[model samples]
Target chain A: MERNNDVWVFIEQHNGKASDVSFELLSKGRKLAETLSGSLKSVVIGHNIESLAKETFRFGAVEAYTIDDQSLANYRTMPYSRIVNQLVDAHKPGIFLFGATIVGRDLAPRAASHSKSGLTADCTDLQISDVKYLRVDYKNLLLQIRPAFGGNIIATIISPDVQTQMATVREGVMRLEPLEKPGIGKITKIPYLPEAFDSIVEIIEQHRQENKVNLKSAPIIVAGGYGVGTKENFRFVEELAHAIGGEVAGSRAAVDAGFVTPDRQVGQTGVTVRPKLYIAVGISGAIQHRAGMQESNKIIAINSDADAPIFGVAHYGVVGDASQILPLFINVFKQKLK
Target chain B: MAINSIVMVKQVPDTANISGQVMKEDGTVNRALLPAIFNHEDRVALELALQVQDTYSGKVTVITMGPPRASDVLRECLYMGADEAYLISDRKFAGADTLATSYVLSEAIRKIGRYDIIFSGRQAIDGDTAQVGPQTAEKLHIPQVTYTEEVLHIQDGKIRIKRKIEGGYEIVESGMPVLVTVLKDAVSPRPYKARRVMTYKNAKTLMELEKLVEGNSLLYIDQLKDEYLSKNLYIRTFTMDDLMLEAERCGVAGSPTKVHKVESVVLGGGQREMFHATKAGIGELIDKLMVDHIFG
Candidate 1:
């Protein structure tokens, strides 16, 4: 079963439920399978994943491969990578996908190196197309599109010579559509034999702090970027959000510059927010930042540079200093709200 | 417990501040036109390694694989209190994807010999793959901990680490010979020391010394290398011959993935409307937003 035109997605699950990105990949994998005239399959590896396997059918997966074991309940580097590598070796898939989260980054590369497959990390887009390399024509090469050079450029990667082409996509980039009528759900169970090496690293303890900043559900979001300049200047962006009853968010640059926390970042690496109203202040709307908030109902951009990229996507763009424009806008907004 | 640790480092271009003339006409970034600097996350990783050495009686050795010019970052590593440094350079190792990069690095690490803990930045800025540390671990047949935020405890070849998960963090423990990829927020990296800088500024690799010898006949590369090595100023340099690497698996040939095409970013937005910066214009915009029921 090596090199089947099938598209496979690694269903990452914790506890008993699968993550959102896995379902999103399933939805997109179906489209890629159709483009190749093949089938979409999902691989769920975790304990008590029987229900999770059934859930993949609603996301258009024709088949689900399950490997459930108590020892494999939580994600351990050795066990997970070994089992996934064995599966990849056994089933020669043409394309494989994983969510570009912490788990995926840790596991995908091990599989890639073990299987000697071509794998691209943090891909934002995936497509199937024919290509020519070294004067040889290749059919149905998986085009892995991703941001590179610190998100300065987009690169399309291909593995014309490898049996399986794989890519890890960031969460929230793909659309998750549940089928009205679920697909033909079929689950194939694989046995897990615990190896001595599986217990090398132990999870001695864990703590979960639910992110207090839930920007996705916010109705209105006021976001800032590196252009906000400093932590003090960023207050203007927040003041406007406060005046308008909007949530506070920022770009990755803002997070890196210590203007905002990483949880409040509105970009590809962060949450994908489609708030009703998105006010972007002092942001250039790089493709990475824009990827997360582009779906907002209304996008208003305020920046000093009139030709800034944020203006391109903004429904209403104000060319001025955010420090000045934000105060005036907040004053007027408060007066109107009163 | 005395430990031997290795920190993988990289020199990346300042991708943010690069203005015009950085991108070539073909839509690819001209790295030569951009300013190259030590990657911040790797600096943090180096700092973590140094802290580990401070707590436990250990020496931290840093290594980076790049062109001859990459020695600059190695010198910076020495300035940051690294006990030793290694520069992996070879023309054949150019154009490596993460897979190939990890393969070559795994081989190079084996040559470097004997490390209890291998530390690296979670991912480099330019590639942002975050794959090398774990992939190299896999190649080395070792367990890995990625997205590590901090090292809670390290003693007697056992380490307790706090790593970031989806919405939370987990504390994991592993014995020696484990690979831990550090997050940027792990620790604030210390600044370079003036005394170390003064001493290591002339630190050069054998390749660099050869170039100096070529430019001036008075300088002999072997004598220069001997002098530096005697003074402990030689940054351990390795070529393809130094490591047991398959040429087919070292660089472009070893890379399974290829860049089909590169495109300049053009994130075009759906709508385009401009409002004046004037106070009256701001008021009009606020009124419009209120009518839309978003501002109010």
Candidate 2:
């Protein structure tokens, strides 16, 4: 084991509540810590966030660093960056992982800059390489896999020179570690100085829209793609989602068409979801779209073309018009519920 | 008086495409095998910045951080109506992520001297980190507006911009010397002007013309660099030495992030059993979901 041995995962939180991605990172971080002969640690930053830290221990973190300050409540780039920066410098960790959420997207880069570390964003896969001591061979490297080329290909990247390897994994890509035992993690409170925090940019107000759906945590997701045809056809997907008591998701194509918001998008450019049941309607299943939802427990694809790429990874493939098939499925489910 | 804007652009490898053999197992992307071109969203961002330059009666300078091959985007920038183009290319800047990248770019921006605005795409498709703009802004200690979809109006040293939010959008107002990260919908970058392409075709980075001049000759590399600098044509290539950046604080040595593992997940849908419409069956279905921890 190295002298400064700790595996730290940034437990991303919003509005004093922890994001599910934090648990996912903890799941993966636990394995990485074991491989490197280190202990798992988590950094939680927010106001009144001790409860979130308690949850971190249930998911494999042995020690949790909590920076609970009023200024740290809502995520502003500078303050959050400063806090994470302070922690990394104080406790040198072998690896720092974050969920590539909106807050993570804003904070990770700045933290990496402050720490002078390399960061790979939106990675789908992460692994440590076992390399022999110096002799010029392929054995010594940490391979980081991410979708590239607009999601057409998966690139395995390695950092052979850096000590602490950092990456931002997409939300829902990894399953959350079960909370079998009560949390046995110790919490350390970092001193905060409100006077030191000064942000040139202020998040004036966060407007919560009426139709806001937490797609990241949705259990049942019915997603649409380009094959959903025109913008009007997307309604069928929404109907299906409503029938199944789930939220509506869209491929990058549907989001680009303005049919749905980027938050509801399911793909490399959008949110990664691991719902209990994912019904991909009229989606041809580009690797980019699949990168986001391929982790779902069950994938049911409805496309007119049987040879559509979506069917390749789908657990159940129905070759028919989504406009027609969705309504049928919705009616059947409704009748069954009745 | 209007403000001058300089946008730093780069031509990254189309990293989205990754076959096991894309790197030839040699760690370098096979250019012939893989396609190389200007970054798509960066081009659009350049266009948005150029539009501001045209409206405000100022010059737009395009800068890129890459090898001599990156000169292509520089030329393309010139054709797109940029007043000047610079390429910051050096061996030390290779394999840089957003952190190291911002360091090199900030140095080049400093060398270029004065500018009111810095424009960059929200993120490059290749590395979707979206960190460079904010990081550069942080290093420069300037205000930054990210995910900007439209530049509403600029007047009296105050810049009004519309930035994309989660559900909708928000209008933000900032003073001059602000770094704006542009979204794809901001403005469509214009096509290259044919005349400028013809005139600036001879523009060359020191490394580009090094082959003809040889390792040593009447034209010293430093002197040529000076000539370019004097002509305002120098790309302001900076090494770790120029930035006074400690070698340990740059490149892979400086980066502490690592990948733990990689696995491809294949989602499979579960069994679907048609349920009877009776009251007992309806109650049972709801109970099953609750028991499974999927719903309650």
> Highest TM-score, which number?
1
Please list the C-alpha lDDT of all candidates, in the order they appear.
0.87, 0.73
Which candidate gets the maximum DockQ versus the true structure? 1
Q: Cα deviation of A32 in candidate 2 (Å)?
A: 3.8
**lDDT for each residue of candidate 1 in B1-296, tens digit (9 for 90 to 100):** 78889999999888877676886876667899888889888999999999988888688999999999989999999998998999999999999988888888888899989999999999888777888888899899999999999999886668999999988999999977999999998999999899999999989898988888999989988889999999999998999988867899989999999988878887673667678998889888777777777755
Per-residue CA lDDT of model 1 for A198-227, tens digit only, reads 888999877776668778789999999998
> Residue by residue across B1-296, what tens digits does model 2's lDDT show?
68789887868676645444765443434555666678777888899888887788888888888877888888788778888887776676666667777877877788788998899888886667788987787677676778888887778887878776644666667766888888787888787678777766767776665764695577677777777667655544445565576565455444444323323433334444332334444345444554555544
Chain A TM-score of each candidate structure, as shown: 0.95, 0.84
Q: Show the lowest summed lDDT stretch of 10 residues, model 2 chain B.
A: B258-267
Off by over 4 Å in 1: B25-27, B216-220, B267-271, B286-296
**Model 2 chain A poorest 10 in a row by lDDT:** A132-141
